[model samples]
Target chain A: MAGDRFPVEATHIMMFARSVADDNQIYYDEDYAKTTEVGHIIAPPTFVQSSAQFNPNYFLRPKVGQPWFGSGKEPTGVKRDAGGGGGGGGGGLHAEQHYEYHRHPKPGDVLTVTVRPGKTWEKEGKRSGKLVFSETITEYRDQNGELVVTARGVGVRTERPVDQK
Target chain B: MALKASQLKVGDTYTECLVEDLKRTQLVMYAGTSGDYNPLHTDEIFTTKVAGYPSVFAHGMLTMGMTGRMLTNYVGDGRLTKYGVRFTSQVWPGDTLHSTATVESVEDGIVNLKVETRNQNDAVVLSGYAAARVDS
Candidate 1:
């Protein structure tokens, strides 16, 4: 339950779609969905984004006990962190996202998730100077060990913490 | 209700806007369904006192999830090549999110879109896009 072993259930897919107000037939409507290329009810394109849920240690979640940029001193030469996407707040903010879908997630599919820290660099921002950008890539694999999706995200953290509350 | 990827031309727009509430229950359901159970999205006391937020807000993925519907429902049963978003502002309960997606370019049998999502005050809360391959 901590990591890996994410069971893909039809009900969860349907509910996830519904939670976002998306009722696409491919996610439900078994009869119609079967007529599509997937031949089964499938998860949406961003479904793999939920892969973080499978592992509590997955980055991007709150209170994961990891040293996030802006929370502490900058690592020597800005290293690539493969895990620990901890507690997103001001200074460290999610800036961009990307997903490459090899295939749609289907019911009964057990997705194995892996998170790796990619490139971390710095730049200047107009409002928030010295913005450090970090990229975290999460990969999802199916039961047959085929790549299903890859999600790349960029988080921008300012050098100084700005509190609104 | 499905269109071939070839049929999707640049400038095609998902005119039917998507708007939804950031309900606490909806966030709870997402936690149970997605298994990301971060208290910042559920526990009011934890988010307010501990995390120093005004209240429990929706997950950034939840915003991406909602904005994603605009594309999925429009593309209908088409295959998705890519979908993503940048979480700009905190989505609080009762905030009405409005979303839109426009076809920016089409190439190599793939359709690219420009997406915009704003809250009730017309402030951008999320920004991203999608690319999907179509079949005849």
Candidate 2:
């Protein structure tokens, strides 16, 4: 069974940070952070993304059932043969990432991250007739569980064409 | 009122200073800290031959971190409302990063800043905007 996702404590954020780097005083220095407009410490722009480490079951799903994925542990789905036959063979690759933040995350701010899949479709290319693209969305919240940041990332999945070697 | 773009007149700039870490040790430290193992940043052969870079380089976030530090140091901590940037160019080791900010506009207590980072080569390594609310 999967464990329930908990609110991200302030200390958790600091722990993931590389503290020896003096450049990160904003996250570690409460006195320094109080002087800023947000009036508290703030996480780096990519802080939200770096804050959480997801289990492989969630991340490695797209690569399963494809030859390029090399024997993953997930249960196999139907594979489509590229030649319009019965065999399905393909894999996934990271395509792009985008982030939007409403405010700087600070100490004492409890965070909850929710992740889900987005668009999925297939298209034909000059060389390949049908290729698929999948998108995923990750949303973050603050102590009161307020929405603060949203990230959407895309991945590309390709299946070999039926006629191609 | 939210920070307005119309408040800042063109050409308002603030200069920020950064101490140089010329030994390349800081770059190595940043690599270890950030967990970014791109060879173009840490490997000499990969950087020189594959990436065509002159030498190892700092992580993009290292420069971004320096810029954020500059903002907090300038406006005082907790004053920044939102800070963001788009990585534009590469910064090699031995490159000194200089962070700069300019008032783009202010409205409804919000101040918009045009921020940039320059290397010792005087080339902009990253450029973008930031927003924050000033005391009412």
Candidate 3:
């Protein structure tokens, strides 16, 4: 979710809500939502998480052509070529997720995401020994350039698994 | 939505929503909708053989999405100023989760809540907090 702009539209919001099976009226009915606290139809709380779909620079888009933990492809760290996280030996899993929202996102908002550096640590696991955890922090700013949300996505790579490809 | 700024107080426990089932199709649709093709979440074989899991599990975002549903349903839209959660366990195919949001505090027309989601077995799988501006 670093340095990519995601467009907020009713379609994406509706699809995300449907995919997750969230029937909250605030995400749907405009007339009903306006009668509530928000006064307008707005996205679900985690709707900002959908930015991964449009942000090519998102760290965990796929195994093919995404960024990796120790990959030195990006000399400057912010700008890098695609396919660093690509290949046959990739089995990273999202371990934890946390989000902070300044405002509920609505349609017609353009948000820019920027990935900031975070800490990395090691923890021993029962199934996978000595796993390494990396936390990547992402910030999304609205079209007004005001910050709307900040997300922390943690990824885990197992060191004990021999066939983790 | 029984919460009102004037009537609310600290230690008030209120609101929950079922997280529904963890079906394979739900994960597939989420991968398509979210563009996260991570094999750990989408590929059954890869999840079993490579990641050393029993089967493909729901994306952390999927559970987080359910948690979001719980939050929005409780405080309504535009009230949630902050919400965050941590995944503690894997959600298998038939598992169901339910989360409750409890009022932690009240100040300046804002309601702060501590939220926790548990599996059918009463295991806490996700826990977090949310702060909402409930002035009206």
How would the docking of model 1 be graded?
acceptable
Q: Which ten residues in a row have the lowest lDDT in candidate 3 chain A?
A: A74-83
Give per-residue CA lDDT, model 1, range B1-136, as digits (tens).
Answer: 5556667777877744465565799888776666666666776764554345677778777788777777777765546778878877778888888788888887777778888888888888888888877554
Q: Which stretches of candidate 1 lie over 4 Å from their true place?
A: A1-3, A56-93, A123-132, A156-165, B5-7
Which structure is stronger by DockQ: 1 or 3? 1
Better of 2 and 3 by TM-score: 3
Best of the candidates, TM-score: 3
- In the range B29-117, model 2's lDDT, one tens digit per residue, is 55444444334345565334333345666656666666766665555444566666655565655666788988877777777788887
Interface C-alpha RMSD per candidate, 1 decimal: 6.1, 10.0, 6.3
Worst 10 residues of 1 chain A by lDDT: A69-78
Candidate 2 regions with alpha-carbon error over 4 angstroms: A1-26, A29-46, A52-101, A108-110, A113-138, A151-165, B1-10, B22-24, B49-52
| Maximum-DockQ candidate | 1
Interface RMSD of 2: 10.0
lDDT of 1 by residue, A70-104 (tens): 22233211133332332333335557888888887
Q: Give per-candidate clash totals.
A: 5, 23, 0
What lDDT tens digits, residue by residue, belong to model 3 across residues A17-52? 887888777676778877875587788877787787
Query: Model 2 Cα displacement at B20 (Å)?
Result: 1.7
DockQ versus reference, model 1: 0.40
